[model samples]
Target: MHQETRLLIGQISDTHIRPKGQRYHGVADSNRMLAQAIAHLQGLDRRPDLVLLTGDLVDKGHPDEYAMARELLAELAIPCLVVPGNHDHRDAFRAAFADHAWLPAAGPLHFCVDTHPVRIVALDSTVPGAHHGAIDEAGLDWLHTTLAADRAKPTLVVLHHPPFASGIPYMDGYALRAPERLAQVIGAFDNVERVLCGHVHRLMLRRWAGTVVCSCPSTTTEIALRLQPDARPASFMAPPACMLHLWSAADGMVSHLSTIGDFEGPFDFA
Candidate 1:
């Protein structure tokens, strides 16, 4: 049997879903936005082969919120992989998403998903009792050993925190601690095609460690683009979106942003 060479991955992050009928920060309706995102994905011409919920699955570490997030995500037609963020409770997340075979029964929720044309390495960067992210020694060792085992496969490293600092001051303050460690591991691996992340609540693309690191925008709120000292982070109702990563034998890997919601389109240039 011949394997499919082309692959499409849908990535949604920073959902921040609150308990039923509740809004994020008392304004953004996360549940409604997530539903719209799911509907849009369902109607896409070429549906994604798999979906990844990068992190921040809920606003608070509550059982009800995890239940709600899990319920909403269950609507997707394709397989979904998940990781926990600073705002998430690992135990609750594991319980809610136990059906995913990649998820472990305990410890850091890290695993590898092998699909045609690409392999995804989901890293757990959340630190207990802290908003900032870290990979710790054990996680780093695991990452190093994992990448070394299969050096030929095209890999996409998924994590909740942005390894590098974004220009936005307030958001940068919450960046991953000692990112150089993560950088060293990735730098050693030439097969890593991209690093996909969430938690920044905005779309960011850049070249790091000889590979591309792209952060997906939140499905709930858009973070303010304030690039200055003492700039406070704020989210607005700009637009909810997800990242589409396409990979093939010929083209390698490329990503595009799929903005969710009603819009005008199909205008021809003829």
Candidate 2:
């Protein structure tokens, strides 16, 4: 049996697998990135109990892409939960990963987990044919009821879109359409621990309604960060990366950034 006392969760988001099996940004092989990340996970001393795949598993919401996603994820030795982003096809995703339990099916895969001291809530914020994210009223109601149902366990909310903008203009524009409502819900709950998201293709952390909000980076490509206003945005010279999250009742949750590559140049420089 698994230990509910403390949990190690691995997150990989936004693979954007090219259907034709094309390379990304002319370097940093995409499929190989996933493979290498798995190897890295295997090397981890403390293995993750579960893997959360935030979104954008496929580049264009194509079945072929989801098929590739299955093949890539199948190499992992841990259980995984998947959600869809604007670029994903829900039906296709469901067909690909048929084993994932779907409930309160308003849309983008809403599920809950009682893994750690803090319960994990996976929300679907993707609206079909759109980039911006929104949690429908029914979903929000479910969230409210779900939180109200349990106040003992601190909760961590995971979604595909950042509830708030991440300072990047293009991505910020496509952020959660109505963030105040999200904030209000979290604010209402003293047990809400942290909020997790992926879509900006970078790591973004901010405080919202007295809770820690973090957005994980992409598994394949990263958007150019826009610290300064410019007609053009940040570039993708940076490699594909993900975040490994460690959670404990004694210490809370800690997220660590990870790259998706395996390089064997030099163990030691002499």
Candidate 3:
């Protein structure tokens, strides 16, 4: 029998940090929001074992923006794993986060991290020079081989683009290409606990191919929720948030959203 193990993971996505002193649009400051979120993560009763930054680390993928991001992220006490989003430049991202040896020097950034309770497989869904996401044959083969390598451990797949189409029309247009292929790959593994994604800039949860797919909202601005046919493309400064994925053998993996901000708390439960 697999001994019950508990692991807590923190995920913050779409940081979209601009150069120092620059704001994301004229309003939202990615750095400030990220700092607050980090403070909140650290303040949790139990700290996470690892923090995953699911892409879009910078607004323009510029060196200066990456420098600012690196500096802000340095406050984290746990191991931080990163993947590239559509807004990211592969070379710039790799260079900026060079300490992460798991990142390939110059290719699709797909790798797996073996941690206590789950095997985290981060897939590179960003296609070069494109906004939409795709996992080519090679990426799929890599995923299959990686998952098959060890079947006992529970798995968590992370990517920038979600495989399922969200009701938000504009974002849906850029949804992951050929999702059926991803489905097939995920379906092959019964131990996969969840697929965590970011990019839509909203918090959403759905089940795709028997696995839960959850998209984390951005730490900057959020895409306006317009599910109607006539809805126009717009973004709103909705409450910035991140997710905490907790795992244990008995309860499996459960995800919770931690909205960034100071809130009144804990009076005695008596």
Candidate numbers, best lDDT first, in rank order: 3, 1, 2
- Candidate 1: what lDDT? 0.90
Clashing pairs in 3: none
Residue range 123-223, candidate 2, lDDT tens digits: 88988888889998888888888888898787888899988867777667788988898888878988887888888888989988888888888867678
Work out how many backbone clashes candidate 3 has: 0
Give the lDDT of residue 230 in candidate 2.
Answer: 54
TM-score of 2: 0.89
Local error of candidate 2 at residue 135 (angstroms): 1.1
Query: Which should have the higher lDDT, number 2 or number 3?
Result: 3
TM-score of 3: 0.96
Evaluate all candidate structures by whole-model CA lDDT and list the values in order.
Answer: 0.90, 0.78, 0.90
Tell me how many clashing residue pairs each candidate has.
0, 1, 0
Q: TM-scores for all candidates?
A: 0.96, 0.89, 0.96
Model 2 clash count equals 1
When 1 and 3 are scored with TM-score, the better candidate is 1
User: Model 2 off-target regions past 4 Å?
Assistant: 1-4, 24-28, 103-106, 115-117, 262-270
Positional deviation of residue 60's Cα in model 2 after best superposition, in angstroms: 0.4
lDDT of 3 by residue, 52-165 (tens): 999898888899999999899889888889989999988898899788888877789999998566899999999878899999999999999999998878999899999988
Task: Give the least accurate 10-residue stretch of model 3, judged by summed lDDT.
Answer: 261-270
lDDT of 3 at 252: 91
